[model samples]
Target chain A: MQLQINNKTHEVDADGDTPLLWVIRDNLGMTGTKYGCGLAQCGACSVLVDGEIVRSCVTPLDSVIGRSVTTIEAIETDPVGKAVVAAWVNHQVPQCGYCQSGQVMAATALLKQTPNPTEDDIAAAMVNLCRCGTYNFIKTAVNEVAGRKEASL
Target chain B: MKKFLLTLIAIIVIAGGGLFWFVTHKPGSPFDGETASAAPADLVHRGEMVARQADCVACHSTPDSKPFSGGLEMGTPLGSIFATNISPDKQTGIGNYTLADFDRAVRHGVTPDGKRLYPAMPYPSYVKMTDDDIRALYAFMMNGVQPQNVPNKPSGIEWPMNMRWPLALWNAVFVPSGTYAAKPQQDEQWNRGAYLVQAAGHCGACHTPRSVTMNEKALDEGGTDFLAGALLDGWYAPSLRQDHNTGLARWSEDDIFAFLKNGRNKHAVVFGSMAEAYNNSTQFMTDDDLKAISHYLKSLPGDPARDGQPWAYVAATSATGNAGKPGAQTYAAKCGFCHGTDGRGKNEWIPPLAGAASSLISHSESQVNVTLNGSARVVTADIPDAYRMPSFREQLSDRQIADVISYVRSSWGNHGGPVTPEDVKALREHTDPASSNPIVLQMR
Candidate 1:
């Protein structure tokens, strides 16, 4: 299979039925996309498919061949990714640092889709399960991302 | 040629002398790995508190795992590493540790013979512990704990990477110590609880989140989310803060004290990390300390908005009967045999299901998971007879499991939430029922 991962094309060896998670982790050596639940019940395997946050655990590799695959690795490359990471670190969004990559991807996509998200917007975006239950921080940081002028500017 | 020879001889002599001096000056430093700190009373007392604050017993003293002899295989992305014996046994434990040696191991994350302890040991969190606490912990281990001859099994952490020294860098950025200082603005009980929860107990070790560096983001007061809640291992340690959904939003000060003291109260029941806390740490605490913890917890005002619609049990359609639902039927089949028709569990033995804290807490996850997986049999000293809630994995399907849990939650005065089969299935995949022969070991 071929994928435009992080804006770079790469040929990979793996079954198509396998979730994009294994391809990123075992095959691509990008350990950033964690495997909290292979079923996507926990959004720990969330990544960007065409700038929209999708649970990579449930997403098949073959389905998104021509589409772009953006992960935590390339998150810093995108403009929205910068804002999300900055907000995450500044407000300290993560607790166990396990569910956060997905949280960030979701929040980034949310902000990209809607620059100013309210509490409800954040709640909807943060459906990912954080065992540490950093939901409060998640709400606070995304709120900061929305209020900050940099998000739009 | 003559000058070059003379310089070489001078360099060699100085280098040899420097090595000799360096080795002698740094007492019990990394260079000298053979030192031992004998068990002293002071060391023992301190170690007791340090261990309590760290909740070391929670994981180490499992049903089969010897107390501090460390056979409980804690799970991680890096595979399982059984907790090690810190008992003073010369053959099987750290009876060979010196003060500085223990200090390095405790606060610095270095082991007695100069190796790094994995973050799983919570050295990253302990790195914030003060020197005094470290010394006291050393004293406690050296003196307080009985010696055990059980050898520590090697951790499953694979080759070359298992080397401990690299953890030094992980520590440098993340760990910073200086015992908790109370907020002058907050009253005494709150301060006391904060101190106990953060420092003496190091509750945040499990309760707080970590940064990318794997260090606890904020140790105490500076972070609003401190002691709020975080997930560790398989269980979710609910927020110590007064949040509505999964925290003590509606719990009173007295309720907190009761839960900590006896393990069950009207608002919540002790399960998961909390049960261990009750079995080992909180249950052993003095009344004043419990009150103080309660008082502190009470000071945290819950976000009424998020805590949302306070739970009120709707009267059963018949007022005195189980609703004719799959949940009710499943409850009768597997659970009602022990829990009673009313959902109130037996005292000290089978924890009551109705109106208990876990069921009352808005988030139905813990309630559903515990019912499906059953509880880890509590084992304390002198009480060899322990009771375990058996796993329903094979006997019940996800829908059946969800119905049974939902029946318990909604039946009596408890109002947790209506659980879905999806929730049960998710937990079923993630969790394995606790062992009847839990990893308990004995220190000599």
Candidate 2:
């Protein structure tokens, strides 16, 4: 099967039902996406598929056959992703750095979808879990990227 | 007056003797007079296939036990009864028994010593099995299977309730003794399918409702209640009939075939007890047999009155409109990713909650049980399914489960009705081994 990952088409040998995270990390050798709760509960394996954030651990390889998958490796290429990365660095939002990539992908997808997202919108969209309690920092950074008044909460 | 009293006593004696004979009598078997002999290799091979169709091992063997060395405990109203060892061991199993003994036990629910086997053995359904199949099954039991020296466990029922003679009367009233007669009106495929479902598959053992006496209401499609859906073992097996909402009205013959063959279809995936059937029996059936089963099941008509309004998907007007409702937020956070916000699961991989039989049926046991305890893995063709419903018992409260299930059952044109926290509580306590006292339904 051919997969469009980070704008590069690659032929991969795998079952269609194989999780996209497995194909992305093992088959494509892009390990930026982290595996947390494989049941899609913890969204640590978040990746942008055709501009929509999908939990790659639950997303089957066949579901994204022709779609573009943007991992943390290619996040800075997009304007929105670039801005989100800058805000993350400015905020120094990394305790373990394992979940930061997925967090960055999630924030980029949110800001891209809702450029002027309010507190409610941010709360709804930024549902990815960060065990290091990096949520307040993530919210502040996402608020900065959205060009909104810095979120006090 | 003394002469009249004597006559009355005589009459009473005769009637009592007749009643005793009727209850204790074993039905005659064609193999009765024959001696035990080794069966041909081909007959034994065919017998193995017959056993697969019957799914004999599902109850007869536990995970750790040797195959056919039955020790699985089944809960009944009287008490728990253990499935007897069917392997041909000389002492512990049925090795010493002749072919006639096997036939009587399998088809007539009678032991050689005049004990009546419980209906849990499903001999009512097995009675429809052809004589040839019985011979083959007997042959396999004697020759193909390894003789395991596993002793049969006694029933936990106490003395008076454990008496077997009454069940002979129950069998007489409820069980029909005959092989499946081909309906000349229907095609060969339908007849073959009917034979499998009614006889070997014994689908009605779960799908058909039981009477107060614990007899299945209907043994075949001749009765409307046959496969009309029944709740058992904490799961509601949905109707095989063609009802639009709670049955297979929307599923095509091909869809049914795919479901049986592949363990999944676009409309639903095999879960609950059906997963065990699929894993052990249905998936192993030949393509032609599956097609025949599909053709026959499709012929059973659904009742409009019983099924109520047919379900069709009603698109949610707005996400915000449903946000205020109980369990909405829980669904979005916990379920929406895999099941989708629309409740249409990811295309054949994850089954759609919208218009699903679990959601459409008024009996919400399947819905609640699956939600609270989660589903068993659906393994198809040796490959475990990519997705599975995770257990939420520890994560969510009984109220949360009820609220979320209520939200699902009521949403997306599903009319499964509201499930109360008590409903969730009962099943939770029942399924949880730590709770100790599970509510066991006393089958009258």
Candidate 3:
């Protein structure tokens, strides 16, 4: 299988049914995308497939054969991704940062679709789970990128 | 005159005998020589308070599991031992236990059936609880808790190692069966901190190093190792002692209070096992109690020779053409954006990597764990944080991660030393990403 990741195409031979998480982590050794629960319940393995946030742990490798896969490594290159990462750092939002890659991806995706996201939009879009419970910072970072004055709960 | 002298002699004898009895005779139980009385409603309330002081729910309850249902598996040198259900269920929990049974179990580390419990239960410190407190604890466990039928899981310890008899002997040597007596020299706040740290908080359980026999090296401030920190469950619980880099030497009393209250301060945020402690126990502490804890912790002196010179931040000039260096490019590409080329973080939120404890500590476990698995969430007051360090495990090779870490450690006057790829690989194999559902206990 040939997959485009971070704007680079790679040829990989793995089972079609193999989850993209394993393909990225075990086969390609791109571990920034974590395997939190393996179940889609946690968004730790979130990655952008043609700019849509998908739980890669459940998304099979075959699903991304033709689609462009953008991960945490590449997310920074995108304007929205860079802003989200910057906002995250400025806000000091991470603790035990296992779920952060997915968080950044989700936040980046949210910002791209809705440049001026309200607290409610953020609440609905940025649903990735963080064990460190960094949601307040997430909201703040989102608000900062959106150029809002008010804080989100 | 003779009659008067004889009466006086009889009175003196009776009084002397009474004094002797009072001094020598040990009270067997709270109920001894008193008629059986029902525990008052207020006593049950007090019992609940006592249980909270002990922080029983932290270990006894699993995340999203029933309170005190006791399924949390604790790792030991022998094997893993699951916490038992103490929720007063007759079939599986401690519902069938009498007050005497509770006392023996809590203080003596013995079960109703004469079986010895593993020392992991913290009964060594609990033995210091007063009889009244124990009675109240019994009342709380019996009356306050909702009984659950969750069956206790048997330990995974192998046969000879799993045998309970040795623990009795171990207890005899290590456990002190007496209530805490306040030191006359210390102030009330210090005494309170001492009581809470030594008994209820069980700070030594994780922070204090263990003996070859798996016993806590020290139980009180008298021992240098107490609260000096030990590695547990893949993360190093840095010393609560006064050690400059690794301990609380640099933390002010206010810093300590703030960390306890808010779960994060300028220096560091609570993560790993401590996140659970903050979520369930420390955040809810009274302000006075938090102050007292800080006061007590600050009294501990640091080892100048071991802790080395106090860390001073040194400014770093950006070196051009450093991309040729093994880790320099990785740092520039990966870390420098957040940490900066100077290695000083942007603000209080983005902790400075230069002289940061995570990079400066002798143990690289924390760094490796965070770099590999990423941190758990840092929730304060039920609000999740927004910023998070993404895991670099997949993006960077073990060698790359090690190289970058080494660069961070050696640079900006950080003296923590270099970490090897082998070290990174070992930690990566053992550790998992921080769970989103940290053990947040909701104790009533």
Candidate 4:
């Protein structure tokens, strides 16, 4: 499989049916993309496929061979990623580090597409499972980054 | 060969002796499931009281979910670990657990057969629970709960890290089993609140910051940071102290009671973990207990240095051209429907964002997150209102959110810190909308 991860191209030897999560984790040694639920239920395995946030746990490696696969690692390359990362630290949004990268990836995607997202927008997008249940802080960071996105524009 | 044999024999002798000493000298476990030959006549009654005091059902159970069936996934720094099956079903749950097993899990941070439990179990706080409460909790969990056939989900923690034996050492360092003692001068209410919050409820599990060792910073009121709001699980369990921003500065005892009882009042509604606390613990609490919590919370003094300047709204032009100012326009277009133009909502229904303790926090972190994701659905009392704040993920942009939120904060004399778009983006990536479908695990 030839894959573009965080803008870098890599060739990997893996089964086509293997979840993108395994390719990123076991094959490419990209530990940053976590394995949450292999099922698409939790957004912990979320990554950007051609700038669209997609749950990688369900996305097959075969499907995303050519598309840009953006994980949390590459989020800062985009201005939206930078803003979102800043907001997360400022808000201290991570409880356990496991789910954060996915959360960040989804947030950057949201900001890039929509400069400003409303509370409702936040709800639909940030639906990752946070067992610590820090939904309140997530909203604060998203709103702040949205403002910053506007300021930059 | 002689040295090896001597060492082996010595090892066996030492190991056997250690095992004997361990059984004899182990600190009495609070949740041990060792059942006495004769059952206490009021074991079930005591268990009910203990369950209420600890608010055990809040995290272990879900709204419309199973009671103590343990399917709830608790997110930790490691990974999302599902709460274990506490119900007594030998095939699937803790049916075979003895009283000693329950005590170790609850207070000693050990499972049956001495399996160490993760700190996520809140044993650090639970260790403060009284012996009687532990016994009661054991009785309640073992008997009151409907035995579930649900199998326990393995934790997401990777291999060597998932091992539980190390937790025994962790407990040795942190867990201290002692009931809360009342201060000589403080009244009954304060003591009651202290006991409930510190021991049974384990509010500090979320409210207090953790150390490098993951132990809660301070166990009691000795440390000023006890319940003094540290960011956790994404949301800051805003200071329980009476601070201008992010504390109980503006809430009267009655207001606190209202919020706790019904999940929403005039000021704010509980969401996130607090929402669960309300659904499982606070709402069911007796009126006096709520008042005790209020009294305890109000006594905590705020730190002006940490809180920063009180929020004063001087409306600026909205960043978005869609409305008068982006902030005001967003508020007018979106928020006004529920919060109203004045920032006040219907009593005990939609919460007014004005003068909310959370809105006043020096950091706009919690404020930004909640507005973006909307609130956990509140269905309390006989009134099950379907009017939830819709997810605008498809609608507004982040800047639009900031402007509107800034307007609300400033407009209502709320001195909450100004929000930044960077903050919005970070949380967007960091968080997901709370599931509207409550993880209700029905155990029977």
The candidate that achieves the highest DockQ relative to the unseen native structure: 2
Query: Candidate 2, clashing residue pairs?
Result: none
- State the displacement of the C-alpha of residue B192, model 1, in Å, after optimal TM-score superposition: 3.2
TM-score of each model, paired residue for residue: 0.59, 0.93, 0.67, 0.65
Can you give the lDDT of residue B298 in candidate 1? 63
lDDT of prediction 2:
0.86
Q: Write the per-residue lDDT of candidate 3 for residues B1-444, one digit (tens) a residue.
A: 999999999999999887555433332444334433577889998887778777789888977678899988887767899999999899999988778778878877778777788888888888777788888988888888889899888899998887776666687689876877888899999998888788777778888888888788988889998888888888888889888877888889998998888776667767667777777778767888889998999998877776766777766554633445578767754566445667765344345677777776788888777777766666667765433456777778999989988888877778888999999999889777776553457554
Pairwise TM-score winner, candidates 1 and 4: 4
Candidate 2 CAPRI category = medium
Every candidate's chain B TM-score? 0.75, 0.95, 0.86, 0.84
Q: Model 3: runs farther than 4 Å from truth?
A: A1-153, B1-49, B319-325, B332-348, B388-390
Q: How much is the lDDT of residue A126 in candidate 3?
A: 76
**Model 1: residue B425 alpha-carbon error in angstroms:** 4.2
Q: Choose 2 or 3, whichever is better by DockQ.
A: 2
Which 10-residue window in model 4 chain B sums to the lowest lDDT?
Answer: B313-322
Residues A34-126 of candidate 1: C-alpha lDDT, one tens digit per residue = 998553456788898899777676565765689999999889899889988998888777778999998899889889988988765666556
Candidate ranking under TM-score, highest first, comes to 2, 3, 4, 1
Q: Which candidate model has the greater lDDT, 1 or 2?
A: 2
Clash count of each predicted structure: 37, 0, 27, 79
Which digits, one per residue and each the tens of the lDDT, describe model 2 over residues B1-444?
Answer: 999999999999999999899889989998889987769999998888889899988888876688788998999877999998888899998988888999999999999888899889989999999999999998988898888998899899999989889998898889997889999998999999999999989999999888887888888888999999999989999999998988888999999999999888889988777877887788888999999999999999999999998899987777636666899878887787788779888767778999998898889998888777777677676667767777888989999989998998888888889999999999998773211111111101
Residue-level lDDT of model 1, residues B1-444, one tens digit each, is 999999999999999777545433322433244455455665676567557656667666556555677677776677678888777788888877677777666655666555567767665455556666766776676676777688888878786767555565565567664445668998887887766766556677777767766677667656766666565655667667677555776578887887777666555456665666666777666677788888876665555564445555444656556756657755643565345556654443445676554665555667667766766545444342233566678778888888878777777767677888998888889887766543323322
Q: What is the lDDT of residue A52 in candidate 1?
A: 75
